[model samples]
Target: MVLNYIWIGFFVIAFIIALIKVIIGGDTEIFTAIMNSTFDSSKTAFEISLGLTGVLALWLGIMKIGENSGLINALARFLSPVLCRLFPDIPKGHPVLGSIFMNMSAN
Candidate 1:
């Protein structure tokens, strides 16, 4: 929620500054520049996501294979001692432990 306010504040500040520039400095193209930059940034972001698509797909595919072939379970069992120590509040065989292990494995 705090992040939302901060993001809104950023836009509000930019708009106020841009308005001042337009009124006092007679900079008519400020909003156009802002819009162009926004579009360019979004395009670049989309491109980055497109570039990562293959790698993301392969990673999820490998994880799925490991799950189906029991490698994930084997890994969880192998790391159970350390994980159990790290997460003392979680019961030994809790379902959440599997997800925790999977998330850790992703990292």
Candidate 2:
């Protein structure tokens, strides 16, 4: 959590610096012009980030749904034999084998 806060601080500082540069470097007009253009690059960037986050959320939700639907269990069952063969030291029917298979399938 501390690391997360530190990262947030870094981003805030970076954003402040960029804003200051734009405002004080006689670049405010250029920035305003860019913002006025139909392209609106800054807005585009924000939209892209929003879309990416939404897509990530959708994927995570889908994965959770798949988990509840037993897709992961089926995959684990299907891969268990191959997993057991790959890790001979792990007993054939051990719970660890299923876990390993599940982790691999998740990845």
Candidate 3:
């Protein structure tokens, strides 16, 4: 019975309830508290992303090197048997498979 409509309905119901709480219930601080929490959450996410920038760059550089050296393609070939079983639709030796292997290693 669960559908996309139900997901949106939950948000809509919560929004209405929040509005009622702020207006009729005189819970004026709720909006301020929500805004403060939202800002704090975004700030924390930004800091984490910033901290990971160096690691992300290092992985991307390694992937680029592997691509240039054809190591990724070699790995893809080595893993082809398992990859073939996991992804039956992709043809053997497909360039996409090499890219997939690169992403897998980068992750």
Query: What do the candidate models score in CA lDDT, each in turn?
Result: 0.89, 0.72, 0.87
Question: What lDDT tens digits, residue by residue, belong to model 1 across residues 1-107?
Answer: 99999999999999999999999999999999999999999999999999899899999999999888878777777788888999999887676776788899899
- Which residue window of length 10 is worst by lDDT in model 1? 91-100
Q: Of 1 and 2, which scores higher on lDDT?
A: 1
lDDT by residue (60-99, candidate 3, tens digit) is 8978898999988999999999899989999999999998
Residue-level lDDT for 29 in candidate 1: 100
How much does candidate 3 score in TM-score? 0.59
What is the model-wide C-alpha lDDT for candidate 3? 0.87
Candidate number achieving the greatest lDDT relative to the actual structure = 1
TM per candidate comes to 0.79, 0.43, 0.59
**By TM-score, how accurate is candidate 2?**
0.43
Per-model tally of clashing residue pairs: 0, 0, 0
Higher-TM-score candidate of 1 and 2: 1
